[model samples]
Target: MKKNDWFLAAGIVIAAAVILLLQIFGSVQNGLTVTVSVDGSLYGTYSLSEDRQVEINDTNRIVIENGSVVMEWADCPDQLCVNHRSISRDGESIICLPNRVVVSIEGTDGKNEENSLDGIAG
Candidate 1:
């Protein structure tokens, strides 16, 4: 390849790397709680300061430890949520589409929480 082409390619790679880094570092914040929803309805919220395991509708189990929450078990066929990484930052979530369950990290200080529904109606 030409020198100018190589430089352009390097510039693109650098820009991509910078954007990735910003996304990784920018979204991280100390979340205060973990919220769980089932089938688009509000299930419950648990404190992150204390570690524990939560069972949602007997279909999914989540373990909160070390200020991070992870899906420890799920009865769904794919088990994608069970293998998801632990989330401690606000806005991070593990969604189980098959089970219609969503587990998300949230902060109560009024910054991380935005436009969230206060209740769900059938």
Candidate 2:
């Protein structure tokens, strides 16, 4: 209602918007590799820059192309993983619950990948 109050409110709004934009842009950048895991075991890691198809334990197929990874095929019942969109951003993932498979993007810095925790485990 007061002039100072309006200025403070506008400043807060601008600050919040800047932080949100930074987070959005930061998450999608510097993701150079994709890591695949099956049944709680490490399966393989692939580069996003390279085009290839990875078959996971004869149950799921992962396709990497054009800086993105997608589940090309799967033997799981629901097919939810197959329908999911490709992941190219850091922290993005395509998980197949039935087959216990997870595919996630890994950033180049390695700090994000090394110290990350799996919340589902706890």
Candidate 3:
């Protein structure tokens, strides 16, 4: 075998071992934290839990309540934005795209984020 081939094989083996170790010990997952800023102003930070809703006003005032969160009210005309639903998982979010009102669930940065958001993966 070429000298470079030996190094490549060793690198591959090391990578596999590390992956196996992570699986055995559980992969390190970054904690989830959410901070809401509405209309470029500081809204609030919310912790993850089931059946929780956070309501915000145009003035950036926020209210947190337990239960499925829905669009209680909005200043926008047509009231189309308040018809949206609630989110319960890490990746789930409700956004009034037209109103620029965004509610996002924070999770592991990249891989499996959507699944986490959807509450599919425990």
Candidate 4:
């Protein structure tokens, strides 16, 4: 291989490493709130800093603790939402399709609010 080729390869590897590191570190901010929606309606927003339990219209149950939120129970048959892992990142979510319940994290940058009502619009 030529000297220029080796330099080009090294530059590409460095660029890729920088991109990967940014991605890993950029999304580390803790979520500020948990927004719950049911049946295309805004149900409630709870702060992750406080530990609490939320009942979503008697259809889904949510638990927030230690800066994370999880679906503790759901009346839906599939129970996919209930099985989802707790999320504390800005864009993470646990959605129950059968019951139309969605639990998601909201970040300070405020991107989620713009798309939060998408389900209702369509």
Candidate 5:
């Protein structure tokens, strides 16, 4: 093949790889958000389910209860919300970085809590 052809092929391959990575990340999860609010102050962000952090340090010292929703995981350096924990009820989630994903528990698209209890939904 010509040199130009090779270069073009390589470019296309690289572009395709980047697109695939984005798609995969976008589909990483499908949950809800549960923002944490301190004593009249806005905390960080978090997602439902997943074993993430709810607060950063003991400076504020906040926590969640039976209420199911997003919880911020403010410990990791990167702080990217991983699969985190797994929520199924009305509120439950994981958090990281400066984000806060919330889980509907009733399904991301709005199905029902029972449906999402198992794990990732369809």
Candidate 6:
């Protein structure tokens, strides 16, 4: 309604746009490695730059190609992990709760300390 109110609205919009752009570009970094874990223990870590398929404990299989990783197969009845999308950005992951398998993307130093909070409870 007022000139100051209009300026305040424009400033808020600009700030929101900048924050959104930062979030998009910041999370777009290509991960350097794919880390696999089973039952809360370290299974293996593979380079994301290399394309290959990995079998985990005969219960799950994953494919890494073109800088992205995807769960190719899983014995779990729900098939949630198998149906999940590929992950290529740092801290992205595909988790198989039935098999207790976690496939995550890590940065160049093979660590994702920043976005480690996978979930939160109210």
Question: Which digits, one per residue and each the tens of the lDDT, describe model 1 over residues 4-106?
Answer: 9999999999877866565454453554788999989999999987889999988999999999999999999999998898888766789999999999887
lDDT of 5 at 85: 51
Model 2 agreement with the true structure over 1-122: per-residue lDDT tens digits: 79999999999998778665554554536547898998889898888989999999899999999999999999999999999999887777899999999998877675655433332221
Report the lDDT of model 5 for residue 118.
29
Error of 1 at 87 (Å): 1.0
Instruction: Show where candidate 2 strays beyond 4 Å.
Output: 1-28, 114-122
Q: On residues 20-113, what C-alpha lDDT tens digit does candidate 4 reach at each position?
A: 5554444436547888988889899998889999998889899999998999999999989888988887657899999988898876555544
**Each prediction's Cα lDDT score?**
0.80, 0.82, 0.52, 0.79, 0.44, 0.81
User: Tens digits of per-residue lDDT for model 5 on 3-86?
Assistant: 999999999998778665543433324455445544435555544544444544442222444434333334435634433553
TM-score of 6: 0.70
Q: Single out the weakest 10-residue window by summed lDDT for candidate 5.
A: 97-106
For each candidate, what TM-score against the reference?
0.71, 0.71, 0.43, 0.67, 0.26, 0.70
- Any runs in candidate 6 off by more than 4 Å, and if so which? 1-31, 110-112, 115-122
What is candidate 4's TM-score against the reference?
A: 0.67
Using lDDT as the measure, what is the rank order of every candidate, best first? 2, 6, 1, 4, 3, 5
lDDT of 4: 0.79
> Worst lDDT window (10 residues) for model 1?
113-122
Candidates 3 and 4, the one with greater TM-score: 4
- What would the per-residue lDDT of candidate 3 be over residues 21-118, giving only the tens digit for each residue? 54433322244434465665656666544434556665222233452234566676666656666544344456565566666556545554544423
| Model 3 CA deviation exceeding 4 Å by range | 1-35, 39-42, 50-68, 108-122
